[model samples]
Target: MPDADNYGNPDYPAQLAEMARVLQLHRGPIAIASHVDADGDAVGSVLGLQRALRALGKPAQAFLRVPNYLAFLPEAGEVSPPRAQLEPGTLLVVLDVDSSDPLRVEGVAIPSGAELVLNLDHHGTNSRRADLSIVEPGKAATCQLVKELVDSLGVPWTADIATPVLLGLVTDTGSFRFMNTNGAVLRCAAELVEWGASLSWINNHLSQQPKSHYALLVSVLSSMEFHFSDLVVSAQINQAMLDSAGAGWEEAEAFVNTIRSAQGTELAVLFKDYGDNVKISLRSRGRVSAQAIAVACGGGGHHAAAGATLNLPYLEARATVLGKIEEQLQIDGLR
Candidate 1:
């Protein structure tokens, strides 16, 4: 089993110390990776730690591929795609993802030939083991854990290092608007800013979406759906919609957040139809558990946001998801 501890566990500092020691002792190349889809938190965590390791004269590479929207992050272009296999004796650090599942780790069938696999994440649902894992569900983002781990490594903070780390904090907290934006993470953000993290640059890039994004957003909004007396809302995007708007999944990824803002919505769903399967993203407000609904469908995430990919076709998946949400509503006595 992986050595695991929550942030408040008395042993947490010792665990971090040991992880730091492991990284320091490893002379082999270090490969950093995160979940697929390469959201801002994943991209930022990967890039930030990769730069920090390199600064320590450790051979580290970001084993992640990002979406176009995230490509603007500092050093994002330098990241390599996950390989079919890694060099022997490589230390593979998978961040912001459940490291126990190779499928979720992105790019590789399994991390073959890795000497050690370390999982650093903040997902409460993560249950599997890695060689070593520090899972803190209380954290606002994995970047917060990354910041602590980097501190343990004695790596001096720099703009290049701090910027990507801040990217994770900024985006994962929804630019500090999400519920996960706690005091500790806000303090971390302030420290990163002090270390020359370019907050304005990140905000500017994020705010400046392409025209296609607006087109795609418009289409998704037009597909507004309501269930359970407007307590639940949803929208969908299919390949047809993507083609019509000349947009991509990246453009549609955040649409769930849009629909979730509808007044008095308890739950919101964004369904991305891919003909044979549908990807479901869920967001919930107050006492409703989006993660529970997602977990029921074989997906995992935070209380407020989560997702799952269903093998069933769009209509079947839609029915199944709606059923799950209704069941959850009933359980919560909201129906």
Candidate 2:
């Protein structure tokens, strides 16, 4: 059984057992994929599972549209984009992906002959299309759930495995400062530390920004806007700004939190103009639902942190998203 403190469906153990059985019965290679943005939780979950399966003497490969900052992770060099050819009966496991839509996984198509699809995630908006899925929305991070699955499968705990799992928990919980941080989260962190996970190294690497990244942050902050008596704050980054700072989309991660930190701000938004589309990141300080706003804009994510891509000009996208946030605030009587 999963630890009582872990957040998951009551039947998680049974599902995990069945998955193990399937892996034991199959003789084909397993391919793991995750969301493209590849945050710490997403990357950690994918790499951690790959290591665990390999430790079990199973043939496994991992795939992701790798994020540059995460290249330091163990076996990260092995991560690749989805392959065009997969052998028949190959099992495809997707980790930490919030939506079943191919676009959500960065257009990674499921190969023609996959015997089974396993979706391991902690997103409430998951479409549940996998043959077997363990979606635990209450968990702080998918890596946290992955740790539970690893333990239930009796996989050996090694520093290689524990490091990534701890990375996921730390980043997803904002260094254990997010609202989801709970007793189980702390306990899991303590256990991982005991298993040789280095908290200081993880925190330093994640928090240390390059000079260019700080420049990008300055540009974004310079464009900040406030609305609804500063209850809703927004900042935008254009390709020009990114070029000036010599930065990319990954460098802009967590920049929205700066906006959210402003006093009286209940909702914060970061809009990144990616030429063809604008990616909108939403963050909330409890009074509004970021997930609701993202979903209304044809995107999905957690209640506190959500994102959507708008196929519109920068100004149009900003207006559309702000309109939705305002509507949600009105409905919730926050305006």
Per-residue lDDT for 209 in model 2?
Answer: 73
Q: What is the lDDT of residue 127 in candidate 1?
A: 71
lDDT of 1 by residue, 121-145 (tens): 9998877488998888888899988
Candidate 2: deviation at residue 261, Å? Answer: 1.4
- Per-residue alpha-carbon lDDT of candidate 2 for residues 1-335, written as tens digits (9 for 90 to 100): 43464344678778878877776667888888788678899889888888888899988888776677777886636677766666677888888884356676742575335678888888889978888887888888998888887887688899888999999999898899888888888988899899988999888787777789888888888999999878998898888998999988788867887778888888999998887889999988877899999999999889989999999988888889988998999977898
User: What C-alpha lDDT, on a 0 to 100 scale, does residue 150 get in candidate 2?
Assistant: 82
Largest TM-score belongs to which candidate? 1
- List ranges where model 1 is wrong by over 4 Å: 1-8
TM-score attained by model 1: 0.96
TM-score of each: 0.96, 0.94
> In lDDT terms, how accurate is model 2?
0.83
